[model samples]
Target: MKRISTLIAVATLALAGSSFAADRPVHLRGEVTAVGAGDFVVTDRKGTKTTIKLPEQAQVLDVSRSSQAAIQENSYLGIAAAPAPQGKVRAMGVMVFPEAARGLNEGHFPWDLGDRGTMTNATVAKVVKKASATELEMRFGGKAQQVVLDKDTVYGQFVPGKRELIVVGAKVLVIGASAADGATAANAVMVGRDGFLPPI
Candidate 1:
């Protein structure tokens, strides 16, 4: 049994693109993009991404994705890639909302995505600040939505257009029981937990 690197790829979401559980050491020869329930995505050196399903019934050996393993790996080399979901057309629709998705969300992790539900085409806005460095907040319509992040804290990286401010501008679907259309919300009322998978 070989081993795979256990790394969480997404931000704070439970079933978006993070670790669910580890049953066996399913090894592949590329950087892992996303880790899910018995599955993971890998991109070769040619910018070609393949999502490999982990073995459940039988053993997976010399685990590589190709018509023929060696030929595919050899042709594509030196390509930078990351792991994403395999066969997931959209991020949170089926992967995080169905049985297979449900099986994944229960994996060993601290993900608390409480089915707070979906928000689509939500406007991205930032909180107004008077200081150079301050906590970031988003204003959607008349409501303000506090930015919840995995880092969870910031010392001084709140410039607009940067990573800090950009996340607030990114579209999202807040996962919790009381799901709302984040696009029409009025103010910064707490909608769900910090657990979210940015739809970007």
Candidate 2:
């Protein structure tokens, strides 16, 4: 009876922890203001400061400055966009994936950016430059999507990075889980290098 009670108590604690982590998902984009032992502070564009805890196993990716010229035919990309006219999407930001990271999360799904924001991870089939915008025809999971990138679109490329990249004044995009007490813990952190901001 004692062993059974102990097993039940452990199981309940595990379930509670999982539920707490799942209850709140955090996505933050901002500039790092301070880095401390196992935690950091970020201030968003609107000056909202948030403290984020970094776990020992948190994944980090470095984003480097990129331009439209880097987006070529057959290139893989992760694009954050919103629906536009005639069944197309307007690119808000584009992330050029490295060749080794091709086909990562290849799908089109709803995003958290805005009311109608979506994220598409696909391979470029064709590219066309117009007077005011660059158009890309992309394919993923047997579906096609048209994305238009205008002058305001941001671009970056992903590269391997270490925890040392997290420093003051560096731009970052973090995906984390929030506990019931409102404490945020990072699951992944993307840091921009050389003054480049993470585009998405």
Candidate 3:
């Protein structure tokens, strides 16, 4: 899969744009402070409080349990991994973004997971398991990222999130369009199950 280079097709948060496009995709990451009938409150990384209005038709998904064995060639993945020598990346956790969310945040960028860590949105070009760990060749656009998944690497998958997952203090990422009502009008929301941060 080719990487979606634009932020609207990749990652975004509280970005400014035209408000007239009802289906314009915006991205947000924050902590859930409240949940009500049709909306939830989020305080972004910058400590700015924003209301995220969820439409009844919105898709809500949770990060469910998964395994490293699920890693395969052609898989679209969001990897929050550590940095290694020679510009390699070491995987601590891997989230297999579903086909529907493929190219949602496509590119290699710095993430807050670790001090020197990075996030890569790409398709698996190859996967090889060695005696000690698994090596992955992930390609995005014209570039490639090398990732090593050790035995202790954790796995996460997107699953349908029950209403209970939207409760207080959950970390979330919302993809939506601007609304005249000030609150972001979301098309989809991904809430991390338990205390897991939405790594994408």
Best by TM-score: 2
List the global CA lDDT of all models: 0.23, 0.78, 0.72
Task: Give lDDT tens digits, candidate 2, residues 1-200.
Answer: 32333222221111223434455767789999999999999999899999999988676777788988889999988888889999999998888876655665577877766678888888999999899888999998899999999988988876556789999999998777787888988867888998777876
Candidate 1 lDDT for residue 40:
44
Q: Mark the regions of model 3 whose C-alpha exceeds 4 Å error after superposition.
A: 1-34, 37-59, 160-164, 168-188, 193-200
lDDT of 1 by residue, 39-118 (tens): 44444335554444433322211111111112111121111111123411111211112111111212222222223332
lDDT of 3 at 66: 76
* Candidate 3: tens digits of C-alpha lDDT, residues 52-138: 887776666776657887878998888878888787899877888666666665778766566876778889999988998889999
Error of 2 at 107 (Å): 0.7
Error in Å for residue 115 of model 2: 3.8
TM-score of each model, paired residue for residue: 0.18, 0.86, 0.62
**Cα-lDDT of candidate 2:** 0.78
Clashing pairs counted in every model: 16, 0, 2
Task: Point out the higher-scoring one by lDDT: 1 or 3.
Answer: 3
RMSD of 2: 9.5
